[model samples]
Target: MMNIRRAKPSDKDFVLDFCMNTFEWGDYVYRVWDRWISDPSGLLLVYDSSNFPSTSKSIPLGIIHIVKCLGDILWLEGLRVNKIHRNKGIATALLKYSLNYGINNGIKESSALVSTNNFPSQKMLEKLGFSKFLEYRYYNINLKKYRDDCNVSIKPDLVFSKKLDIKISQFRDIFSIQEYLSNPEISKFCVSKYFDSWRLYDLNTSLSSLSSFVRNKELLIIVNDIDEIVGIAIVKPSGKISFNGMPMIQISYLNCLNLSIFVRVIHLLLMNYCDVNLFNNAHFLLPVFAELEKILSTKSIENSDRFFLYSKFLDTTSNLSSILPANLQ
Candidate 1:
């Protein structure tokens, strides 16, 4: 027999053993295990298998985690199944359980990120009714290499030649920032959501949400000589350590007036926000733009990987049978 239950502290070793090689670089499950287990707004589940006598203990076969974000978004992540138990419906069961939990808790939508190369996972998500909403690529920067190759003292010629008078400063004006984000053009660029700390939140431009960013001092804005907002960058410490034990940072969202401005903003961020002795690397989750790609290539920065954001709406008024299979229903 098999069943799913809340993950316990005792399941750490067993779960981590299988999660070690989830990808070429390994997995992040271990890094987030504690946070996921302790998160009150999230659920960490383990699939237990029992085939022995009644007195024997059930063994963990798989794991899944779901986090409730602002705007009633359910962020699903960390789905892993033991190699020996592959193709036995373990992943499907875990996903269904998490989805049901979200529905019961008033979650309106569900989202997950998958690698562009993971066809199996993509097929599974399609089978489960998720649609590919957006594509993003990770542009990784090596702080030490970047600092050595590029002179940060001088501004890029592109921005300097344009003679665009701009300054990079911390953004705190919640009202104005909210108003700026509400523009249809900006909204289209943001794609109605923002990535932070590896989780996605609806870009509703609500005062409360923007205030949280302000409190953390993670919001940066580019303003012209007249102090009009021209660009924005949402960056924060990832609370994760690299393999070499250095700290990691994430560029959650970035938008600028043009390619030159965008490049300038990135250089400014490297000079001001990223301290080579402090941060080891930064990961940028950016929308797929051809011009941006060309500029990044010129800077010797290559995309590490591409990912697809999948989303599905869960109707609260409908029965589970309408969306889930009979067994799950």
Candidate 2:
């Protein structure tokens, strides 16, 4: 058995090398880890010379990056064991350590995410005591779907709309990024706990650096009649096509409202996220199973049992699934 340590600054180069070689989507892996590591609450699990039993140097064999949610749940965002070190039980050891850490440290549960095609990793997770959980959607939705002829029902009194008029050149600066927590019923569903101001600003800076990136995006603000930011639709260029006729919304933003209104937000997000014309993520629909076909003309994403799962098990985590919604988009 090899000893493990939390990743340190010294491991940055080695870790980066491992990530580049092992991950099929190095950008995706780096982006997710970068997003989480902004706070010390983020975690990294690494294996040294021991786990491999053969490595002479404590080469970076595997890594697991986690994000904290309400203290109870930890998202195992990035988990990889080097290809050279595969089949040596290193993956299992690192995961077991992390999961035990979560449970022991009062984390109620842990979740691991694998792309739909990564069946091998999924099988490994199952062996480590993780069962398949809810599905999720991820995307930057295509904004070309708004139709002038269509009468989509948004509360006129509470709904607020603004046309993104900034020049495409200013997509990053005056990107018109608006954010508010909604009763996921009224607004679209695309948000996370860490989508705070800092993260948004960071996204602005980072996305700006990736210039020449085609951007058919807008940040739609859902304001109450009083003009307070109540909800937000984080529209972006999904590049993902939905059979429904629009590019998909890669992600959404919502503030869960009262149970009744929450239902509406749920419907809104599902419909928006599911529209295949844009691309859809149906597994994100929890607490409801309104037939995809009944709700939309064509549900683009599959409602699958295999989902990217996370758990919440912190002390202050009571009712995070239901709490005073914050201002996020």
Most accurate candidate by TM-score: 1
Q: Over the stretch 1-329, how does candidate 2's per-residue lDDT look in tens digits? A: 34676676666677677667453323344444444444577677677766445567766777877555543466675677777778887777766666656554566666655655677878777765567644443322222232211236434322222311112223433332222232334333332322221111112323442232225444444333454444333444434333234333433333433333443443444444334344433223232222334323332333332235433233433432221212110
lDDT of 1 by residue, 155-244 (tens): 457434343333433345766677677666775555666687667776656776667676777777776656777777787775644423
| Steric clash count of candidate 2 | 42
| Candidate 1 lDDT trough over 10 residues, lowest sum | 320-329
User: Compared to the true structure, candidate 2 yields what TM-score?
Assistant: 0.49
Q: What is the alpha-carbon lDDT for the whole of candidate 1?
A: 0.72
The positional error of residue 160 in candidate 2, measured at the CA in angstroms, is 14
- In model 1, where do residues sit more than 4 Å from their true spots? 51-57, 152-172, 239-244, 275-277, 290-293, 296-303, 317-329
